[model samples]
Target: MPSHRAAGLVAGLLWLASLWLPAISLAARHADMDLQAFEQNGWWLLTAGWVGIFSGQPAWLANLLVIGLVPTLLMGKQPPWWVSLACAALSLLSLALPGTTIHFDGGPYRVVAFDIGYWLWLLAAQIPALLMLTELNVRRRAK
Candidate 1:
């Protein structure tokens, strides 16, 4: 079994890689009533997404799961099982991002689809917690 630290490091690397890949496809109606679509990657979301909150996009808040996991994963030792479970639960918040409406440049865009980056990010977010849960189960069975 992999150690928590190893799992964390792997997850961290995945999260980093995800930042550069396409995350979401957004569609909005132009002034002429034509629909336009564009893609945004994870880094864009991490940096500029804050402005989205005021524009009725709450999915950005799910980024906090990754933010919160960073310090815990960096710790010297494994956190309690409950901490892992909490992280897992928090990671689920990202699922709500799909179909969400984001107002940008006076136009409302819908999150039409999630791309590779978003899926990778979700996988990365769950890795450490899943590893921790597996470890806990193993230990319990051993005892």
Candidate 2:
């Protein structure tokens, strides 16, 4: 078990766990609508094939991508670099896109912030990317 492979396993597990955590937290200016309401409305992390609280189609796609990539990440030894790159790119895109936007009927608006899940997912994606790059460089050097 190489260090990079171990790291990938840990990161991949973290990423899987993150899917259950809140991807985003919401705060509204109006007291009438609070975090609980949004949460109840399904604004938490996606699990069991259900979308996150604020997550839309993109979120589902992101999850599927991660899920699809995690196995490759676990393979570790001589894993395809392209898969890692794709996962990294998808993670970056997911991080950049705002999960969902909720508007209240008031003068003020809602404030949304990235949560633990987002950071963990991003880290998980990067772990494989970095490892694959390093492995490729090491192999090239040896040759």
Candidate 3:
């Protein structure tokens, strides 16, 4: 019932918001961001460059974000026998990545509970939007 453009816009907005949430959380808590580790591998640079690129054309990037989430949904690691496993897998992946954590209990590392939740929740929304768009495209082609 929705258009590809609509899907893209929604997904894009959510994706962009998702990226910012972690930074905001960290700042709010006065938590130490492991920037040195994030920078050492050029991952941060690559990520920043990516965000910049997405900034130019958010809708298309949103579609891409949805596509990316499909893999996570399929094989991540939650546990619902459906989208759960993949969400779980994505949670683990989120943990593995930089700039995703929470630390307020006098620990060396930030906890990743919120990071994984945000990523997976946003992803669940994205994956369906993408699938709807894909189906729409297919139906149009058939007609």
TM-score: which candidate is best? 1
How large is the C-alpha RMSD of every model relative to the true structure? 2.8, 5.2, 12.6
38-135: candidate 2 lDDT, tens digit per residue: 32111244542243324443434445555655665556554566766776776675554443444444443233666676777778767777877877
Cα TM-score per model: 0.81, 0.64, 0.33
Q: Any runs in candidate 3 off by more than 4 Å, and if so which?
A: 23-110, 115-117, 128-143
How many steric clashes between backbone atoms does each model show? 0, 4, 12
Best by lDDT: 1
Clash pairs detected, candidate 2: 42-53, 43-53, 43-54, 44-53
Sorting all predicted structures by lDDT, with the top scorer first, yields 1, 2, 3
* Candidate 3 structure quality by residue, lDDT tens digits, 38-127: 111122222442443333422223334445544443443221233323433433343333344323335433322344325533464444
**lDDT, candidate 1, 1-143, per-residue tens:** 23656776777887888899998999987889888999999898788777766755555554666565655666646656665666666556657777888776777889999999988877877776787777779989999
Question: How well does candidate 1 match the true structure in TM-score terms?
Answer: 0.81
lDDT value for model 2 = 0.58
Candidate 1 lDDT trough over 10 residues, lowest sum:
55-64
